[model samples]
Target: MGDFRRSRLSSTPVVGRVVEWKKTHGWIEPECTIDHPEMAKHQGHIFVHGEDLVPKWRNLVAGAMVEFFLYYDGQGLGAEECTSRKVLRVTLPWKHAKEMFGESGEKLADFEQQTHVTIRAYQWCQPDGNNSDLPFLLFEIWGRPQAVVESIGALAARREQDGNAAEDTLCVNLLLPESRMWKVDLMQLQHYCSLEVSSSITITDPMPCRTLTIQAPLPHFRSSLHALIAQAACVGNLW
Candidate 1:
């Protein structure tokens, strides 16, 4: 049997928005509530130190998005391995498009028209040390066209009408490299799998990138992920 010791801290990173930042320390309002029972004892904000910031930034502006692993040092919940999420507009290439939206068939044409999609990119900091100049890598991309959303909504409604549970989630897929997969501990991944934010991950066959599909809750997805799409859409409207 595998070792089943589960740490109270989070192994996978969670998304959050910065609440405030002092010179040395700050607080972040997590996108989802922390599930640990001990979390009720303190305010919901996650403590973050300046040193923990990836690339070692001095101050984080309020409302800036970030991702980090959660930790509790017997005192309070804190954030570590923090990194800022940079949102940008990206046009997916045909090969990439085939992988993500191939199921859409003729609808792929519609997706092509809406090529300028919003994605949250993160700095690829080195494990040994931080390098401020490293280019940002795309972490999360929203490619769901309006037609797809309507289709999903209809399917959900039908399920609810049939007395089945409604599926209210947006899939957040990750494509991770096979070489790095060995370094990740399956036990730790299993532990975090119970959380709503990390539950939808599915590891498939060996691929060039780290990929998993996560069924993110619709409400949280709207507030965090879809908000970027809305902002990008507004910008497009201005032009």
Candidate 2:
């Protein structure tokens, strides 16, 4: 019982080995290079040569592998090389994701049980660059809870009226920063059966063009709640 939209585009996965460390153009940090076959000849796929190289953002030096999953919509002149515009969907190995979960490892299982909330992965372009050393990718956490969602809406309204008061009030902040690079929207779904937290990042100069959605069940909401509470508890040294 899933609702899907007809899409005009398609996606594919691509992986390229790092060849060199590229420059950030005074815009982005932790930049590097890849020997992607498609990028070599495509007009849209530009390259950073000798003068354009930056030695500072060379954390992932030559030989570190790079992998990205992109949606390819047929367009541009690289039809021979790759006819599609790269959709900005990136994925890292599961091991990498596990490490990013921090100390919430055991707590994650409890969280999943209490709230049917789900966390999704996403990627976006680097706008200001090295202002943050984090990846453009992020994880989104969201869930479905009818009563809680409606109630929180009102709560947020009240907070807005209270001059947005409080230095340390347990305010139900909808948007929480997982890190400097990613932001999550905590919302309850219509049915309250579960919760869904999806993560995505924008690509290209302006941003990504596709829309994203997450579906969940009631049990998922419980799991999500458990995780959220555990996170707060950990931060408060409750564990």
Candidate 3:
């Protein structure tokens, strides 16, 4: 079972044009202040760091392109974490990998695989519920606790209200916005599978080009021993 209490730290920052700006409290909005000359006419949405969300960060102006960091920390690998299955363990050119996984191509190959997975990284937050739009770090994962992803999708598919898309890509979908329920459900699914899950991560991106890297207590992940097999099964019918 995956234990989110272990305190793992990771982060990723994306540069994009800010589309809106708002400052409810004393937060500085990045959407209003940060400027991205690279995209003077082109438009793109910045991936807001889930952890950092200060009142000041909200000062950003709409249409201002800025690079906001996404960091994950505080969570650690618990005793009940997901067990790893088979890992492809491929090595490719950094430039080519970056084309697909962004400048931080460290774990590029892991991201391309169409596997069910979820990444647990540190998120910045103030003492209160407030945080900045920038994250301190970032991490990528392709498959994990395969059982968790499979089970959750299955449960959601059973429900009439749940759509087929939700069932097909529950794990991938959750990556955009990691949630507590999904995290808890991942652990629960592990128990049901009776399999030991582990993680295997690699760093391939160069520092000079992309200075984004996470420092953590855990060793650099390679390939996992365990693999998510066909046991879990699909969640719902085909769309």
Query: Candidate 2's residue-wise lDDT over 47-157, tens digit each?
Result: 222322223222333433222232222221111111111111112233444554443344444443343333334434346653333433343333333322322222221
Best of the two (1, 3) by TM-score:
1
For candidate 2, the per-residue lDDT at 226 reads: 41
Q: Lowest-scoring 10 consecutive residues by lDDT in candidate 1? A: 230-239
Q: Name model 1 segments beyond 4 Å from true.
A: 1-8, 89-239
CA error at residue 73 for candidate 2, angstroms: 39
lDDT ranking, best first: 1, 2, 3
The Cα local distance difference test for each model comes to 0.48, 0.29, 0.27
Give the TM-score comparing model 2 with the true structure, all chains together: 0.20
Which of 1 and 2 is ahead in lDDT?
Answer: 1
Question: Candidate 3, residues 8-127: lDDT per residue as tens digits?
Answer: 222333323334434421111222323444223224232332123332333434433233342223321111111122111122233333454457544533543333433223334555
Give the best candidate by lDDT: 1
Q: For all the candidates, what are their Cα RMSDs to the real structure?
A: 18.2, 18.4, 20.5
How far residue 224's Cα lies from its native spot in candidate 1, in Å, is 24
Question: Which is superior by TM-score, 2 or 3?
Answer: 2
